[model samples]
Target: MSRQAIGKANCFHDKGHHADCTLSSYPYMAAFGIIQIILSQIPNFHKLSFLSIMAAVMSFTYATIGIGLAMATVAGGKVGKTNISGTVVEVDVTATQKIWRSFQAVGDIAFAYAYATVLIEIQDTLKSSPAENKSMKRASLLGVSTTTFFYILCGCFGYAAFGNKAPGDFLTDFGFYEPFWLIDFANACIAFHLIGAYQVFAQPIFQFVEKRCNRNWPDNKFITSEYSVNVPFLGKFNISIFRLVWRTAYVVITTVVAMIFPFFNAILGLIGAASFWPLTVYFPVEMNIAQTKVKKYSPRWIGLKVLCWVCLIVSLLAAAGSIAGLISSVKTYKPFRTIHE
Candidate 1:
């Protein structure tokens, strides 16, 4: 939600008015948050298949558009041996900075492809079948492969076109003198896709919180009929009042945080650093090692555990660097300092 809000805010950046500028993200965040909450309140998770399709379509459309734009730039004779000046590009790099950036790149990769975070839930959405494992394996393989290809393709083309002039966000790297309709379309697609993605991720968190709240304040089956709705076309549906309240509150809290700290890269880096190792690397390896009963200190066990240890150390360093970077950003931060800024 925070990242989405920040992205939306970038759409209308005004540099002169620095203070209270990022307040623009608040309305956008609230609007999308409402959409997410409503969609998440759907009776069953499986019913979100339509949303998933929309997410996929929107994502693919924007990705294709972005790639097309990059290729067009390259074909238009924009890229050259001479680097473009006055662009937000990273041309020079020292060894120390490169090392820090490698750690930063880990976080960016984690953010881009953090499938492990919701793999279990996504698998659960699949229909029960004898070949469920096979089906899921094939799906995962194809999805990851396709996404990876696109990622690499886009990166290669984008770098080729912009060279050292690429900004942090490739979309915004399209110079601003001309308000490209394609850029607007791309941002809209991104925002629309995020509406679905937010619900997919937030639904699980909502369910977890609802469960905890239920344990604390058990729902009374005998509650007033107002909580139960009998729509003419939609049949009777029971709405958990407490569930609605808490989820709505959660959306508000996240929105406020997004507005207060509109640093998208920093927050993403932080989340990636925090979740990359535990959710993606350590848990899976440890689970496999335990299931296989790998002998303690054996080469196999050591090798398996070595990845986890390496991930832990690297992720910690990344997280520390991310935090330091975020602090520095905060210290020098100005609100709505133009899109390129």
Candidate 2:
């Protein structure tokens, strides 16, 4: 998405807004993947606090820029057509398509609040003085609330400005054409943020896989041994042959997969839908009920279960919708090509 943002911004800057700016996204994705491959070599999660902090700053920067740009568009009296029925069956969109898109929106929203995946990692870092869970809860609440509010502003105001024609990414996807430098900087921030964010998520998966391999092959030097390399003005760095091979292959496969799909909204929606119910709703709710020893079939327990079931149904529907979208995208998808959102 950041790659597309930068390319689109450059395209708009060079050519007029209405000019043809279509280009392949393969190189950009590959470049981003290579960066991740290097970052993936970081030896410890604890070493990533600096990256996480920088990512937070980048996120704030881009989000604020997006909101400001959206408001500016509206203020300049360039609001796109809006209707009571959001995104009506027009502009080549059908009733069925609209419904599916709406479902995709649900998943997209869920993906926006995807904090659960990183929550435990963060909690692991908290001090023991204040119970970690309590501190995590308060931190989670504040973080969620703040980010949710920003997202709402971006969604509502951006929709108000662009109506049903709004792009998936405000900074990149035809939402704003002028102020090219701001758009470029915002997109750069996105790319920077993603650099750290990808490591944050991928490190855990790497650790899991490496740990499993070490356990399975306890005496295998290829998997368990680490070689140290000294650097000028820097401390010695440790590298493992298995980690290098496994991690590189993992990144390469994922990068190729991304290029194959290249439908950001659809892919994100599908992931969000698949995980929302399981990770965000089901597990947490079940854990809370179990911890509290809530009696089965009691009013509170029943209500909670009912809500959980409702979320499950919603998640299933959202997943189906996203699948439909992916199918639709597949029909027109060209490998290594960017699918316009």
Candidate 3:
């Protein structure tokens, strides 16, 4: 393969750690965050039932996506020319890249939605006033700026405080040890936010799987005849034993490590930073500029390009700083020594 392809393959394979982290914990974070927020508002209600139901629904939804993707890959068969290791690496990288890209897309969507909603509210509040437009404009800008700062601050603070030792879900970890009221609140928030992230990442995979199953399996008749399975449960479930096993393994391993360390935030931070840069800063703008060029329209593409470059620079710096922090943390470790009589 070409050098670019090779580089991509290597990057993907090396990103196995990141893929594991994103697929397993990223969804959980948002779910837990939202669940906490809800519980905080409805403290007296039996919120655990709501939280459990939300988490179960979200987890199953994402898990179905994971299974479907695995099935599609299995059905499509391998690209024969690629090395097995390269392919494995590429898969790992793609999975993590998708997670990060989905995250940024969701962030942008959230900003737009919030801005529109807030602006509408402001317009109603200040209707017909001379300062209405100006006030709304200022508030919108302030809100966007402040929200961005808050996101970066929380991410950075979690990274800094935990270093490479950051937890898989910092907010959830807080819930575990914090006061009862706070823990309950945190769980509620996390559960809800997690469902959003899960849906964003999972829905596409579900659609892809559905498409592939229709194309390849076509009424599930082939599997029944070929595999000699007559049971309705097997067809209804629409998942293979292998896929289930693999996903279970993924969840089991990730949960075990996350529970054991619980404070390995620095590594998580570095991985997240690295993944975020390309997904958030590089890809979208590039795609936009490419599409604009294809349509023979130039709408301040240069400005967008510049913004992308700036984001790239910032992301690189953040990634470097995170790595340096991680290394420093490792260096600071000292082993206990015994005193002899």
lDDT of each: 0.68, 0.86, 0.42
lDDT of 2: 0.86
- Please give the lDDT score for candidate 1: 0.68
Runs of candidate 1 exceeding 4 Å displacement: 1-23, 80-101, 173-179, 215-226, 231-235, 334-341
- Taking every candidate in turn, the Cα RMSD to the unseen true structure, in Å, is 5.1, 1.7, 20.3
**How high a TM-score does candidate 2 get?**
0.95
Error of 3 at 191 (Å): 5.3
What is candidate 1's CA lDDT for residue 159? 74
Q: Could you tell me the TM-score of candidate 3?
A: 0.38
Best by lDDT: 2
* Poorly placed runs, candidate 3 (over 4 Å): 1-179, 191-236, 256-261, 294-299, 329-341
Write candidate 2's Cα lDDT for 246-314 as tens digits.
989999999999988888898888888988888888899999999999999999899999989998888
Where in model 2 is the C-alpha error above 4 Å? 90-92, 337-341
Residue-level lDDT of model 3, residues 1-341, one tens digit each, is 01122222233355641332222333343343344332332211122345445754644443333233333333555212333232233553465443443343333333222223123323654656667868777866885675565555554444444433344444333201223333344444444545443333333333344456657765564332222334465342233433333334444554444333332444445545565546655665677677757333344766776777876665555455455544654565432211111
Stretch of 10 with least lDDT, candidate 3: 1-10
Cα lDDT tens digits for candidate 1, 1-341: 33433343454453322323333445666677677667666755567778888988988987887788778878888873333332232446555555565566667767666667667777887778846667778988998888888888787777777675555567643432123456667767887788888777777777766666556655554222227788789798768666667677887787767766777766777788898888888888889888888899999998888888988887787777677667767787665433233
